[model samples]
Target: MRTKVSKGKMAKLLSVVDRTWRAAGFKIVQARPKLPSLSAAAPDGCIVKFSVGGFGQVRFDAGVGAISPGRGFHVEGEEGDTFPKAPNGGPDYTPDVQDRYWSK
Candidate 1:
Protein backbone atom coordinates (compact mmCIF):
# COMPACT_ATOMS: atom_id res chain seq x y z
CA MET A 1 0.00 0.00 0.00
CA ARG A 2 1.16 3.50 -0.68
CA THR A 3 1.97 5.51 2.43
CA LYS A 4 -0.15 8.47 3.30
CA VAL A 5 2.87 10.11 4.89
CA SER A 6 5.57 11.66 2.76
CA LYS A 7 8.97 10.12 2.17
CA GLY A 8 10.68 12.59 4.50
CA LYS A 9 8.19 11.84 7.25
CA MET A 10 8.68 8.12 6.76
CA ALA A 11 12.43 8.50 7.03
CA LYS A 12 12.06 10.44 10.25
CA LEU A 13 9.70 7.80 11.60
CA LEU A 14 12.13 5.00 10.86
CA SER A 15 14.96 6.99 12.41
CA VAL A 16 13.00 7.40 15.58
CA VAL A 17 12.19 3.71 15.66
CA ASP A 18 15.84 2.82 15.21
CA ARG A 19 16.95 5.21 17.94
CA THR A 20 14.29 4.09 20.37
CA TRP A 21 15.02 0.40 19.87
CA ARG A 22 18.75 0.99 20.17
CA ALA A 23 18.30 3.02 23.35
CA ALA A 24 16.33 0.12 24.76
CA GLY A 25 19.30 -2.13 23.94
CA PHE A 26 17.89 -3.95 20.98
CA LYS A 27 19.97 -4.50 17.87
CA ILE A 28 18.24 -3.26 14.73
CA VAL A 29 19.80 -4.59 11.58
CA GLN A 30 17.60 -2.68 9.18
CA ALA A 31 14.56 -0.42 9.15
CA ARG A 32 13.15 1.07 5.98
CA PRO A 33 10.19 1.39 3.67
CA LYS A 34 9.53 -1.84 1.83
CA LEU A 35 9.57 -1.72 -1.94
CA PRO A 36 6.50 -2.66 -3.87
CA SER A 37 6.49 -5.98 -5.69
CA LEU A 38 6.49 -6.15 -9.49
CA SER A 39 3.78 -8.79 -9.84
CA ALA A 40 0.37 -7.73 -11.08
CA ALA A 41 -1.33 -9.33 -8.09
CA ALA A 42 0.93 -7.63 -5.54
CA PRO A 43 -0.73 -5.84 -2.66
CA ASP A 44 -1.20 -2.10 -3.09
CA GLY A 45 -0.11 -1.13 0.41
CA CYS A 46 3.32 -0.17 1.66
CA ILE A 47 4.95 -1.23 4.91
CA VAL A 48 7.80 -0.08 7.08
CA LYS A 49 9.85 -3.21 7.71
CA PHE A 50 12.41 -3.67 10.42
CA SER A 51 14.66 -6.55 11.37
CA VAL A 52 16.13 -7.27 14.76
CA GLY A 53 19.32 -9.21 14.28
CA GLY A 54 18.99 -12.88 15.15
CA PHE A 55 15.35 -12.49 16.01
CA GLY A 56 12.88 -11.74 13.21
CA GLN A 57 11.33 -9.14 10.96
CA VAL A 58 8.37 -6.90 11.70
CA ARG A 59 6.12 -5.04 9.28
CA PHE A 60 4.17 -1.89 10.04
CA ASP A 61 1.49 -0.49 7.81
CA ALA A 62 2.52 2.89 6.41
CA GLY A 63 -0.88 4.44 6.00
CA VAL A 64 -2.32 6.39 8.93
CA GLY A 65 0.28 4.88 11.19
CA ALA A 66 2.13 6.91 13.78
CA ILE A 67 5.26 5.69 15.49
CA SER A 68 4.85 7.74 18.64
CA PRO A 69 2.35 9.34 21.00
CA GLY A 70 0.52 6.38 22.50
CA ARG A 71 1.33 3.46 20.21
CA GLY A 72 -0.68 4.44 17.19
CA PHE A 73 1.07 2.14 14.74
CA HIS A 74 0.32 -1.49 13.87
CA VAL A 75 3.04 -4.12 13.75
CA GLU A 76 3.12 -7.76 12.68
CA GLY A 77 5.84 -10.32 13.15
CA GLU A 78 6.48 -13.74 11.73
CA GLU A 79 4.10 -16.50 12.82
CA GLY A 80 4.93 -19.66 14.76
CA ASP A 81 8.09 -18.10 16.12
CA THR A 82 9.03 -17.18 19.68
CA PHE A 83 11.37 -14.71 21.29
CA PRO A 84 13.89 -15.69 23.94
CA LYS A 85 12.24 -17.10 27.01
CA ALA A 86 12.14 -14.85 30.05
CA PRO A 87 13.79 -15.52 33.37
CA ASN A 88 10.47 -16.64 34.81
CA GLY A 89 9.93 -19.01 31.85
CA GLY A 90 7.54 -16.71 30.04
CA PRO A 91 7.95 -14.49 26.98
CA ASP A 92 10.47 -11.70 27.32
CA TYR A 93 8.82 -8.52 26.11
CA THR A 94 10.26 -5.98 28.50
CA PRO A 95 13.26 -4.00 27.34
CA ASP A 96 15.23 -4.56 30.52
CA VAL A 97 14.72 -8.33 30.48
CA GLN A 98 15.22 -8.63 26.75
CA ASP A 99 18.43 -6.67 26.97
CA ARG A 100 19.73 -8.94 29.68
CA TYR A 101 19.01 -12.06 27.67
CA TRP A 102 20.25 -10.66 24.37
CA SER A 103 23.44 -9.41 25.95
CA LYS A 104 24.54 -12.97 26.61
Candidate 2:
Protein backbone atom coordinates (compact mmCIF):
# COMPACT_ATOMS: atom_id res chain seq x y z
CA MET A 1 0.00 0.00 0.00
CA ARG A 2 1.12 3.57 -0.64
CA THR A 3 1.01 6.23 2.04
CA LYS A 4 1.03 9.59 0.25
CA VAL A 5 4.80 9.88 0.44
CA SER A 6 5.95 13.06 -1.21
CA LYS A 7 8.32 12.72 -4.15
CA GLY A 8 10.98 14.41 -2.03
CA LYS A 9 10.52 11.92 0.79
CA MET A 10 10.88 8.96 -1.53
CA ALA A 11 14.59 8.81 -0.93
CA LYS A 12 14.18 8.99 2.83
CA LEU A 13 11.57 6.28 2.68
CA LEU A 14 13.83 4.15 0.55
CA SER A 15 16.59 4.69 3.04
CA VAL A 16 14.51 2.98 5.68
CA VAL A 17 13.71 -0.04 3.54
CA ASP A 18 17.16 -0.05 2.03
CA ARG A 19 18.78 -0.27 5.43
CA THR A 20 17.23 -3.60 6.19
CA TRP A 21 17.13 -5.05 2.68
CA ARG A 22 20.53 -3.67 1.76
CA ALA A 23 22.18 -5.38 4.71
CA ALA A 24 21.17 -8.64 3.13
CA GLY A 25 22.45 -7.43 -0.27
CA PHE A 26 19.01 -7.37 -1.74
CA LYS A 27 17.93 -4.99 -4.49
CA ILE A 28 14.62 -3.09 -4.39
CA VAL A 29 12.89 -2.97 -7.74
CA GLN A 30 9.67 -1.13 -8.44
CA ALA A 31 6.99 -2.53 -10.68
CA ARG A 32 3.98 -1.01 -12.46
CA PRO A 33 1.41 -3.72 -12.18
CA LYS A 34 -1.81 -4.58 -13.98
CA LEU A 35 -3.27 -7.69 -12.46
CA PRO A 36 -6.53 -9.23 -11.19
CA SER A 37 -8.17 -7.03 -13.85
CA LEU A 38 -9.01 -3.83 -11.90
CA SER A 39 -5.85 -3.86 -9.81
CA ALA A 40 -3.71 -1.57 -11.88
CA ALA A 41 -1.03 0.05 -9.79
CA ALA A 42 1.94 2.37 -10.00
CA PRO A 43 -0.26 4.21 -7.62
CA ASP A 44 2.04 6.83 -6.16
CA GLY A 45 4.89 4.32 -6.39
CA CYS A 46 5.17 1.33 -4.10
CA ILE A 47 7.77 -1.29 -3.23
CA VAL A 48 5.94 -4.56 -3.71
CA LYS A 49 8.21 -7.52 -3.02
CA PHE A 50 11.62 -9.02 -3.68
CA SER A 51 13.40 -12.36 -3.71
CA VAL A 52 15.79 -13.26 -0.89
CA GLY A 53 18.51 -15.18 -2.70
CA GLY A 54 16.15 -18.12 -3.05
CA PHE A 55 15.35 -18.35 0.66
CA GLY A 56 11.92 -16.82 0.03
CA GLN A 57 10.27 -13.54 -0.79
CA VAL A 58 9.48 -10.55 1.40
CA ARG A 59 6.40 -8.46 0.76
CA PHE A 60 6.27 -4.67 1.35
CA ASP A 61 4.16 -1.54 0.90
CA ALA A 62 5.43 2.01 1.26
CA GLY A 63 4.01 4.42 3.83
CA VAL A 64 4.72 8.07 4.56
CA GLY A 65 7.38 7.46 7.22
CA ALA A 66 6.64 3.95 8.39
CA ILE A 67 6.00 0.42 7.27
CA SER A 68 3.12 -1.55 8.72
CA PRO A 69 2.83 -5.31 8.53
CA GLY A 70 1.44 -6.49 5.21
CA ARG A 71 0.83 -9.98 6.41
CA GLY A 72 1.60 -11.90 9.60
CA PHE A 73 4.55 -13.46 7.79
CA HIS A 74 4.85 -13.36 4.06
CA VAL A 75 7.17 -15.49 1.99
CA GLU A 76 10.28 -14.34 3.83
CA GLY A 77 9.77 -11.91 6.72
CA GLU A 78 7.06 -10.14 8.63
CA GLU A 79 6.48 -6.64 7.21
CA GLY A 80 6.35 -4.88 10.60
CA ASP A 81 9.79 -6.15 11.62
CA THR A 82 11.09 -4.88 8.31
CA PHE A 83 10.23 -1.16 8.46
CA PRO A 84 9.58 1.89 10.64
CA LYS A 85 5.97 2.99 10.05
CA ALA A 86 3.95 6.13 10.43
CA PRO A 87 1.19 6.22 13.08
CA ASN A 88 -1.27 6.42 10.19
CA GLY A 89 -1.57 3.63 7.64
CA GLY A 90 -1.97 3.40 3.88
CA PRO A 91 -2.99 1.16 0.96
CA ASP A 92 -1.58 -2.24 0.05
CA TYR A 93 0.93 -2.69 -2.76
CA THR A 94 -0.16 -4.31 -6.02
CA PRO A 95 -0.77 -7.99 -6.38
CA ASP A 96 2.34 -10.17 -6.41
CA VAL A 97 3.15 -10.49 -10.05
CA GLN A 98 6.72 -11.72 -10.66
CA ASP A 99 6.93 -10.13 -14.11
CA ARG A 100 8.82 -7.20 -12.68
CA TYR A 101 10.21 -4.61 -15.04
CA TRP A 102 12.61 -2.57 -12.90
CA SER A 103 12.22 1.11 -12.19
CA LYS A 104 14.31 3.53 -10.03
Candidate 3:
Protein backbone atom coordinates (compact mmCIF):
# COMPACT_ATOMS: atom_id res chain seq x y z
CA MET A 1 0.00 0.00 0.00
CA ARG A 2 1.35 3.38 -0.97
CA THR A 3 0.95 6.07 1.66
CA LYS A 4 0.77 9.77 1.05
CA VAL A 5 2.92 10.46 4.10
CA SER A 6 6.50 11.27 3.19
CA LYS A 7 9.36 8.89 3.89
CA GLY A 8 10.75 11.31 6.47
CA LYS A 9 7.43 11.32 8.30
CA MET A 10 7.28 7.55 8.12
CA ALA A 11 10.78 7.26 9.53
CA LYS A 12 9.97 9.58 12.38
CA LEU A 13 6.77 7.69 13.12
CA LEU A 14 8.68 4.40 13.11
CA SER A 15 11.20 5.80 15.57
CA VAL A 16 8.45 7.03 17.83
CA VAL A 17 6.71 3.69 17.68
CA ASP A 18 9.95 1.84 18.35
CA ARG A 19 10.76 3.99 21.36
CA THR A 20 7.23 4.03 22.74
CA TRP A 21 6.58 0.31 22.36
CA ARG A 22 10.00 -0.51 23.71
CA ALA A 23 9.35 1.71 26.71
CA ALA A 24 6.18 -0.30 27.16
CA GLY A 25 8.38 -3.39 27.83
CA PHE A 26 7.76 -5.04 24.49
CA LYS A 27 10.77 -6.18 22.55
CA ILE A 28 11.09 -4.00 19.49
CA VAL A 29 11.57 -6.59 16.82
CA GLN A 30 10.92 -5.13 13.39
CA ALA A 31 8.66 -2.82 11.42
CA ARG A 32 7.31 -2.91 7.89
CA PRO A 33 5.10 -0.95 5.54
CA LYS A 34 2.15 -3.33 5.45
CA LEU A 35 1.64 -6.80 6.83
CA PRO A 36 0.45 -8.00 3.44
CA SER A 37 -3.31 -8.73 3.67
CA LEU A 38 -3.12 -8.99 7.45
CA SER A 39 -4.66 -5.81 8.77
CA ALA A 40 -8.44 -5.79 8.85
CA ALA A 41 -8.39 -2.20 7.57
CA ALA A 42 -6.10 -1.62 4.62
CA PRO A 43 -4.93 1.80 5.74
CA ASP A 44 -2.35 2.99 3.23
CA GLY A 45 -0.70 5.42 5.59
CA CYS A 46 2.07 5.53 8.12
CA ILE A 47 1.98 2.10 9.73
CA VAL A 48 4.42 0.66 12.27
CA LYS A 49 4.75 -3.10 12.44
CA PHE A 50 6.50 -4.89 15.31
CA SER A 51 6.85 -8.22 17.01
CA VAL A 52 6.74 -8.49 20.78
CA GLY A 53 7.80 -11.78 22.22
CA GLY A 54 4.82 -13.93 23.23
CA PHE A 55 2.52 -11.33 21.68
CA GLY A 56 3.08 -12.32 18.07
CA GLN A 57 2.93 -9.46 15.56
CA VAL A 58 1.25 -6.05 15.86
CA ARG A 59 0.74 -2.99 13.75
CA PHE A 60 0.17 0.66 14.59
CA ASP A 61 -1.72 2.79 12.11
CA ALA A 62 -0.61 6.37 12.54
CA GLY A 63 -3.43 8.71 11.64
CA VAL A 64 -1.34 11.33 9.88
CA GLY A 65 -4.15 12.55 7.70
CA ALA A 66 -3.21 10.11 4.98
CA ILE A 67 -6.11 8.71 2.97
CA SER A 68 -8.49 9.02 5.93
CA PRO A 69 -7.62 10.18 9.45
CA GLY A 70 -6.33 6.67 10.26
CA ARG A 71 -7.28 3.43 11.92
CA GLY A 72 -5.22 4.22 15.02
CA PHE A 73 -3.56 1.03 16.29
CA HIS A 74 -4.94 -2.49 16.04
CA VAL A 75 -4.08 -6.14 15.45
CA GLU A 76 -5.84 -8.56 13.15
CA GLY A 77 -5.24 -12.22 12.23
CA GLU A 78 -6.05 -15.07 14.57
CA GLU A 79 -4.86 -14.71 18.13
CA GLY A 80 -1.96 -17.03 18.99
CA ASP A 81 -1.63 -17.51 15.28
CA THR A 82 -0.93 -14.03 13.99
CA PHE A 83 -1.34 -12.05 17.23
CA PRO A 84 -2.00 -12.56 20.87
CA LYS A 85 -4.53 -11.14 23.34
CA ALA A 86 -4.06 -7.42 23.16
CA PRO A 87 -2.66 -5.55 26.10
CA ASN A 88 -5.07 -4.11 28.71
CA GLY A 89 -7.57 -6.72 27.53
CA GLY A 90 -8.54 -4.24 24.89
CA PRO A 91 -10.23 -5.16 21.67
CA ASP A 92 -8.28 -5.77 18.50
CA TYR A 93 -9.17 -2.29 17.41
CA THR A 94 -7.48 0.17 19.75
CA PRO A 95 -7.36 3.95 19.47
CA ASP A 96 -3.70 4.24 20.35
CA VAL A 97 -3.38 7.39 18.29
CA GLN A 98 -4.69 9.27 21.31
CA ASP A 99 -2.10 7.59 23.49
CA ARG A 100 0.99 8.66 21.58
CA TYR A 101 3.06 11.78 21.00
CA TRP A 102 1.52 12.02 17.56
CA SER A 103 -1.67 13.16 19.27
CA LYS A 104 0.15 16.37 20.05
| Clashing residue pair totals per candidate (backbone < 3 A) | 3, 8, 0
Task: Compute each candidate's TM-score over C-alphas.
Answer: 0.29, 0.26, 0.29
For candidate 1, lDDT tens digit of each residue in 49-85? Answer: 3422222222342333354578444456636455567
lDDT of 1: 0.39
Quick one: ranking by lDDT, best first? Answer: 1, 3, 2
Clashes of 3: 0
Q: Which 10 consecutive residues of model 2 have the lowest summed lDDT?
A: 32-41
What's the C-alpha lDDT at position 51 in model 3? Answer: 23
Q: Estimate, for each residue in 1-104, the C-alpha lDDT of model 3 and write its tens digit.
A: 11223323445655565667556555533445442211221133334343221222234343234455768565675243222247776444322223233333
Which candidate tops lDDT? Answer: 1
Residue 31 C-alpha lDDT in model 1? 37
lDDT of each: 0.39, 0.36, 0.38
Clashing pairs in 3: none
lDDT of 2 by residue, 1-104 (tens): 22333334344444555556556554445422211111112334433442221212223433332356564445655444223343466533423323222212
